[model samples]
Target: MTHSLRLTHLVVRVAVVALLAITAIGATAALRAEAVVEQVPPGAARAMWVWDTSNPQAVVDLAVARGIGQLYAAVPPNVGSSPQLAQLTQLSTLARQKGLRIDALGGDPGWVDDPTWVVDNWLRPAIATHLFSGVHVDIEPYATPAWQTSRSTVVRKYLSTLDTLVKAAGTVPLEADIPFWLDEVPAGKSTLDREVMRRTKGVTVMAYRNTAAGPDGTIALSAKAVEAGTALGVPVRIGQETDDLGTDPVEVKQTFHGFTVAQMEVQLDQVVAADSSSPSFAGLAIHSAAGYAAMTP
Candidate 1:
C-alpha cells in the first residue's frame, strides 16, 4: 500500500475502535436505567386501606422518606362531612409536593351505588384535589350464586359510571377493586372477568381480611387472584396486611394472619417473579403502609 493510503487506513481503524467504545458505554447506561425494579426499597411502595385522611402530611412524609413509590388512598364516603374534604385537600397537596401518585378517587361501593351521588360527591372533588394519579372503585356487591344473574348488570353499570366519572375527573387513571378470590367464584366470574379489566385501567385484589393468619392462606388467595387477573392482561396489585391480629401467645404473633416476615418475603419474591412471568402482575400494594414496613422480611 502507498504511504498516504496506509496512514488513512490507520486513522479509519482508530475511528472504528472509538465508535465501538462509545456504543458500549451507551448500552451499559441503558441497561442500568432499566434496573430500577432491582433496587426497589423494602416496603417502599404500598396501598393503604385508609379509613380517614387525617394526618396527611405525616403519612406522606413517612412514605416519601422510606422511598415508597405509589399511594392508594381509600377515601370513605361522607355526603355532608367537611372533614373528608379537608383531609383530601391536605393529602392532595402533600402528594403533589412529594411526587407520589395517589390511586382511587373515592372509597368503597356502598357509598358509590347511587350513581348520581358518586358523580356529584366523590368524583368532582377528586378532580379538584389533583393529588390523585388514578381512581380505584371498590365496588363489591358480594359473590353469591343468586347474585350472579344481577352481577354482570351491576358491574357494567358501575364501570359505565366510572368511565364517565373518570372523564369528568380529567386525566387521572382508574382502578376497580375486584373480589380477592375472583378465580374461584364460579358464578360471579363474568362480573369480575377480563372483560371488566379490559374496560377499566387497572384492578386491586383485596386478598385478606382482618381475621386471617398464615401467609399460606393469603399467598394461596393472592396466587389465584393474580392468575385470573393475569389472563386478563392488566395490572394486579396484591393487598396484604399490617395489623397484628389480636392474639394472646407471642409466638403466634410471628405467624399471625399469615403475614409473617418469612411469608411476606416469600410472597414478595414470588410477586417479583410473577411480574416477570406474566403480563398481569403490574406491581404490589400492601393493605397499609404501616403493615408493609412492619413486615418481618
Candidate 2:
C-alpha cells in the first residue's frame, strides 16, 4: 500500500475506536444520570459475571456505581489470539483503578476432556496478560451427555480437570462454579462439592432458587457447600440467577426475572441474614452482568 493509503487506514481505525469509546462513555453517563446508586453493605463481598465484552467500560462503570466488589469477566474460548484481548485489557485497567477484582472467566463442559489444551491456549495466555486478578472456571461436567451414560467415568475426568487447573493456576487463585447439589454426587470418600473445594481456592455455588428459606430455597440448597467451604477453609460465594427465561414465567421462583430489583434485594438480604455469619460465606454473586443490569429497578 502507498504511504497516503496507509495513513488513511490508520485514521479510520482510530476513528472507529474513538467512536466506540464515546458510545460506551455515553451509555455510562446516561445510566448514572437516571439511576440511584444502590448501596451495598459495607465490606460485603459481591460479584457479577460479565459475559459481554462488547462494552467493557460500561460494565466497569456499572460495577463501580452499584458497589459490586468483584467481576468475573468472560473471555473467549481461546484468549491466546482472541480479538477480545484489547477490550479485556482495557477492562482490567479500569477495574483495578476502581478497586475492583476481575477474574478471567472461561469454561465449557467439553473442556474436561482436555485440560492441557484449555490451560495452554486459554487460561495461561489470559493470566499472562497480567490483566486478571484470578481465574473463575464454570466447567459444568454434569451438563455433558457422558455424565448420564457414564457417570463414574465422567466424574473422575472432571476431578482430573480440576487437578490440572489447580496446578496451572499456581499462586493465582482458581475458583470453580458448581451446582448447589454437587454434594450428593459422591467422589470417592467425599462428595464432588468437598472435592472441588479442597482443590480450588474457592467455589461459587449456583444455588439459583430465588427464595432465601425453605427446603428448596437458595440458602437451603447452598448450605451443604457453604458448610464444606467452612470446614475446608475455602471461600464460597452463592450465585443467583437473573435471566428472564423460566419454566413458568409467571410463577418463576428459580430466578429474579420479572421481579423488581428491590424485591430480589429483599430476598438476598435474607440470605445475608442467614449465612453472613459463616466464615466461608463470601457474599453473593449475580449470574450475569447484563441480566442484572436489565432487571427492573
Candidate 3:
C-alpha cells in the first residue's frame, strides 16, 4: 500500500477510537445524573406522635428501636388536664439521649385556627418551657365551610401567630398536620397557599381515618396529599393509622386493622416514590407511638 494511503487509514482509526471514548463518557455521565435524581430512598425517616403525660421516654425508646427518628408532642386543649410541661421535658431529655428530633409541639388538630388567644395563652408558654424543634398545629379548617371561602383570613391569622411564636423561640420549626381535602385549595388562594408554605417549617398531611379508606384507597389518598403538599412548596409527613384499615390476615396471622403495619408502609412508600425529585417530600410519620409500635413495618 502507498505510504499516503497508510497514513489516511491510521487517521481514520484514531477518529473512530476518539468517537467511541466520547460515547462511553457521555453514557457514564447520564447514569450518574439518573442516580442522583432517584436517590431518595423509601421511608428514609420514620416519625411518630407523642401525647402529654404519656411516658414520652418509653415512647421515644420504642421509636428509636424501630428506626423512628421523629416525635411530635400532642398538646391538646383542656390544657389543665394534660401534663404539657412535664411531658415536653421528659421527651426532650429522652430525645437528646436517643439521637432524636422533636418534630412538633402542639396537638389534637384544629389549633391552627383557634384564635391567637390560644397561641398566646398556651403555645407560647409551652415553647418557652419545652424548647422543641417545632410545633405541629393539626388544623382541620376545611371542616368549616366559612373558613374555606375565607381561608386567607384564617390562614393569615394562624400563620401570623406561628410567626410570632417562632420569633420568640428562635429557629424553631413550625409544622401543620392538615386534612386530605386542603390539597386542592385552588389558584386565587395563592395568598393562602404562600402563607401556609411560609409560616410553617413543614406540612404533614394527616391521611388517616378510623374505619375509613381501605388499603388501596389509603394509598391513593396519600399520593394526592403528597402531590398537593409539593405544589404548596411544603414538606409532607404522611400520617398512617395502625388501628384502622380493618385487618390483613395475609401479611400477618393476627387480626387487627385490615390494614397491617406492612400495608401502612406500602402507602408511605408510594408517597415517597411518587415525588423522589423534591426533598420537600420530608418523611413519613405514623400517627401515634403506640400505633407505630403495633405496626409491623
Candidate 4:
C-alpha cells in the first residue's frame, strides 16, 4: 500500500477523472487493450499511472509523446452515474485511438475485506462503460500493521479478493501492483509473487529504487521476481518512483524526483536495457503521470 504511498492509488477513488498521473509504462506503444492483454511489450514498452482523468486530452497526448503504451487510469466509484463518466470515456477513446491501452485502475487496502463492494460498485460499472481494456488494482495489504503480524491471514484474503476480481473481470485481464519483495513471503505452497502471478494477468513490481545497479538498486531488488515471473510465463513490469519523498534516507533513495525527466529516463533506460533480456520483463512503469511530467526540463 505504501510503495511511497503510490500516493496516487491511495486516493484514486477521489481523483479518477485526471489523465496526467503516469503509471508503470512499457517500451513500445500498442494498438489496443486487446493487443496488451497477456502480451508484454515486444521490447521495453512503457506504462503510466494516470489517476487524474480531469484532462483526458493532456493525458493521452503526453502518453503518446512519451511512447507509453499503457495507462492505469483510475476509476471513480458510482462510475455508471458519475458526471465525469463521459470524460473517462473520452480519455479511453483517445488513448485507444492513439494505440494506447487503458486499464481501469482502482484499489484500497480495505477493498480486500469486501471485494464484492468494489465488484458491484466500481469494477462492474467501470467495465460496463466499456471504457477500459483491463483492470489494474493496487491492494497493498502490506501497508497495514497487520501485514507484519497477520501476514498469512492478509495474504489469504488478498489472494481471495484477487480471485473474485479475476472472475468478475471475465475475459478482461486483471493485474496488480505489488511490492518488489513479495517473492520472499510464502503464500500456501508457492511464494506470494508466484501465487499472485498465477491469479492475475501480470504484475508490476514496485521496485522503486532510483538506481539500476547496487545491492539495493532496482535491478538487484527486482531480478529474482522477474526470474520467477519468467518461469511461470507471467509478465512483469518494473515500477519506478518519481514523487518527492523528502528526507528519510532509505525513502529518499527510492525516487527520481529532483532529477530532470532526462535523468530519470536514463535510469529507466538502464532498467529496460538490463531487464529486457528476460521474457517476463514486459516493460517499465513510472509511478505517477503528474510527477513524471513535472520533472525538470
Which lDDT tens digits does candidate 3 get at residues 91-155? 77888687677744454325455556566666666566544666667655555565757766655
Q: After superposition, how far is residue 107 of candidate 3 from its true place, in Å?
A: 4.3
TM-score of each: 0.64, 0.86, 0.65, 0.84
What is the per-residue lDDT of model 2 for residues 93-205, given as tens digits with 9 covering 90 to 100?
88889777888898999988999999888888888888887889999999999999998888899999989987987888888899999999989888999999888888889
Query: What TM-score does candidate 2 get on C-alpha atoms?
Result: 0.86
Which ten-residue region of model 1 has the weakest summed lDDT?
1-10
Residues 138-228 of candidate 4 have per-residue lDDT tens digits of: 9898876778889999999999999998899888888899898898899998889999988877889999998888788899999987998
Off by over 4 Å in 4: 1-42
| Alpha carbon lDDT of each predicted model | 0.52, 0.77, 0.52, 0.77
lDDT at 132, model 4: 81
**How badly does each model clash, as a count of residue pairs?**
9, 0, 10, 29
The residue pairs in collision within model 3 are 109-138, 110-138, 110-139, 174-201, 245-258, 245-259, 246-257, 246-258, 247-257, 247-258
CA shift of 31, model 3, Å: 44
- Weakest lDDT window of 10 consecutive positions for candidate 3: 1-10
Error of 2 at 181 (Å): 0.3
